[model samples]
Target chain A: MSPSKSPLIAVVDYGLGNLRSVSKALELTGAEVIVSSKPKDLLSASGVVFPGVGAFYRGMENLRERKLNSALFKIIKEGKPFLGICLGLQLLFTFSWEHGDTKGLDIIEGRVKRFEGNVKVPHMGWNQVKQTQDSSPKTKDLFQGIPDNSYFYFVHSYFVVPKDKSLIAATTEYGGEFTSCVCKENIFGVQFHPEKSGPLGLQILKNFIDIINDSQT
Target chain B: MFSKRIIPCLDVKDGRVVKGINFVNLRDAGSPTEQAKVYSNENADELVFLDITASSDHRKTMLEVVKATAEQVFIPFTVGGGIRNIEDIRTLLHAGADKVSINTAAVENPKLVKDASWEFGSQCIVVAIDAKRKKSVTSNQNPEWEVYTYGGRKPTGIDVVEWAREVESLGAGEILLTSMDRDGTKEGYDLELTRSVSEAVNIPVIASGGVGKLEHLYDGLTLGKADAVLAASIFHYGEYSIKQTKQYLKDKGIPIRL
Candidate 1:
């Protein structure tokens, strides 16, 4: 077992953050974890984890308020291993129609839309996430130890619709097939809360840390 | 597909899960952390820790338990009992509780729900309602479920269905609907009450209490139309593992994580 020399993963604390659980899981992956909202801390860190639970507009507003938005973009542009959860995943898209027209970070090309139809909004509970491709980068990197049709805890109404289908690392069918995970090289986004998804979730975090270790050596 | 959730509720008293019979009896099930670790691995959708004896010191102990569980178990869990204000919710959430359920406080001061939801999104604010069913004489419809608070010791004279709508409107992400009459009896869930509340609100309603058998879970999901089902004794006593319950639901053609 690797004894904490694993990588410094700065879990961005944007006020509305899931820091404790995320850091706990990250540390279990043997990575040194830091919860910081400052840009400098994120710059020095090996990886950044953006875990949020809130409305998309408010989340974006918070990132902007804390000036962490620019820091996030800097980290991502540098090709640092980035993992986004829930609202963090939704913020990666182009825009969301959550309450009204709200612009996102636009890192990934997609429109965040709410779950329409008779299927309930704020789709909460343990749902299955199927890997879109057998050997995609996200599959090789994130889903390394995770199996197909694995269940991850999800509690969100809005789902991302990335324009590029291949970017969809995984898909979970709530009312219909929506992108549950979006992966483009170093950038990985999961609509589910991995920090709260049990062993399968821990495995996903472990896989992310492994990606960090690989990039280092 | 969105699988129906099967939640196991842990009644925490003095940092240990105790039996449901009485509060003072204190038949220790196990450490909250260990039991949570077991359930996390068991593929349980979620876990709820109700602070039975919610003292100030007890709250601190529960926070430690929550931290320990968060370190070990990666799945989502909620903390309830004696959550009087937004500060309590904030402290619990910071300590790694995914969601915080407010029963007594929420009823006494409905603003707590709105305020908590405003501070920390509705997704994390779970308002637990312990409701008792009363036969409706004037209305020819079904019986009326009355809201009971203070751990089911006090009746608020509030309608269960109406209160559910109020909470949802106040930004409660979900409603933990517990049937007091059906609780611990193991007969089954209050399907009529469950269906009424489920139909009343747009937010997700979790049907809690009264779950004796595996079929009760199915009934909560199908017949009761609840988004999720919460049980305590069935899982705690080893009567059935989360695996057995999930398998039962899956066999019954309900979407569940195997």
Candidate 2:
């Protein structure tokens, strides 16, 4: 892939989350990765990846405080291929009970709730994610070239519950069934970290690139 | 079920594997990145790189090694040793480490643990505790384990169980519990110490040190109730491959990646 023709994807930096590893992984997939906090830089990118690593309330607070929420909404509104990771995925929901009821982006009608049952909190390590029964951008692109039930690295205590189960692109089992990947039009959110999820993880990033390429045409 | 993790740890001094370079330790252990790649290929669940260097000059070298290893090895990797503050954690994470293990610093200034947990998120902060079993459990004596710092040279007099609970509440996501007495002895893990700490906390505990054979790994998980087992010498010296270790765990009906 020519450098000039390669997609310049912006990894939105809200002063939180692991941006370096994501940037490095994106670069390896032949995309020009940029760690940018500026709204203009993120908006101008061919693809935007919003990632988070902290509490739910803090994540929304940072996004709003840095004016990234508006910038992110604008990027999504423009039909850009947007990817939200972990807490970034939760931020798109309506509210989270993480630290006493925090509001989210509401881009998708969902509520983030803590995992409760006999299982351990902060569900770490690799677990299988099965693609939903449909042929959309998710199975057709985000997870393209990857098999269903493929294991991916996950580390989160709370999982998002989309109001419409149809919005769930993939599902994973921890204490019980939880939405692992949610897709709504051009926006994609995954609870698992593709960067640290090993080879299949890297493949997910590459698959996103394909979606970005498809969008340009 | 979340599979039991088998982690291979490498000790580095000035960017070179300790014993391999110094000729005093183990010798011929190989470079960290090379060993790390080999472990990744062997299907080790995760890798931990400890920069045991005291010189500031080698800190940058460690970062380069971490960067190269992170670039080549595609798995969860953690870096520890000499991490004093959140800035150190940030620098290492920026170099591509998935997590940072805070030991002496977390003990000296407990606030550093809270600060790091918030800055990098609790999942990224691993509080590594080196605990030594207190002699005798008489009514007048303290609890079973005491937290030690400065390479186990200084005893903080803090109860290991209490410390384990404190770190978790302080926002630590995981604990790397090492037995100072069992370290390098290869007898097996301090099962009592591991059980006490694991039972006392809600987060995952990685039982480290004192592993001479494969059964020890099983005992660490089943007997000690640990989430993971970190072995250095046993796997580093080529006595056992990660494949064989996972097979042993599997045969014992333990949930493993293999």
Q: Point to the candidate with the largest TM-score.
A: 1
lDDT of 1 by residue, B1-258 (tens): 678888888888888778532222233436877777677777888999988875676668888898888777888899988999888899899888999999999988999999998889888999999999775645776688799988789988899999999999999999999999999899999999899999988889999889889889899999999999999998877788899999989998998887
Q: Where in model 1 is the C-alpha error above 4 Å?
A: A1-5, B20-29, B136-140
Error of 2 at B248 (Å): 2.8
DockQ scores of the candidates: 0.77, 0.54
Please, what are the lDDT tens digits per residue for candidate 2 over residues A128-195?
Answer: 88889784755567877788888788888899999988888999988789999999899999999998
Kindly report which residue pairs in candidate 1 clash with one another: A198-B75
In DockQ terms, which candidate is top? 1
lDDT score, candidate 2, position B79: 95
Global CA lDDT of candidate 1, please? 0.86
Which digits, one per residue and each the tens of the lDDT, describe model 2 over residues B1-258? 468899988899899887442222423356788777678877888889888899987799999998888777778899999998878999888788889999999988999989888777888899999999888678676458899999899999999999999999998989999999999999999998898898888888999989999999999999999989999988877788899999989998998876
- Measured over the true interface residues after superposition, the C-alpha RMSD of each candidate is 1.2, 1.7
CAPRI-style grade of the A/B interface in model 2: medium
lDDT of 1 at B19: 56
Model 2 segments beyond 4 Å from truth? A1-5, A135-137, B20-30, B138-143
The DockQ value obtained for model 2 is 0.54
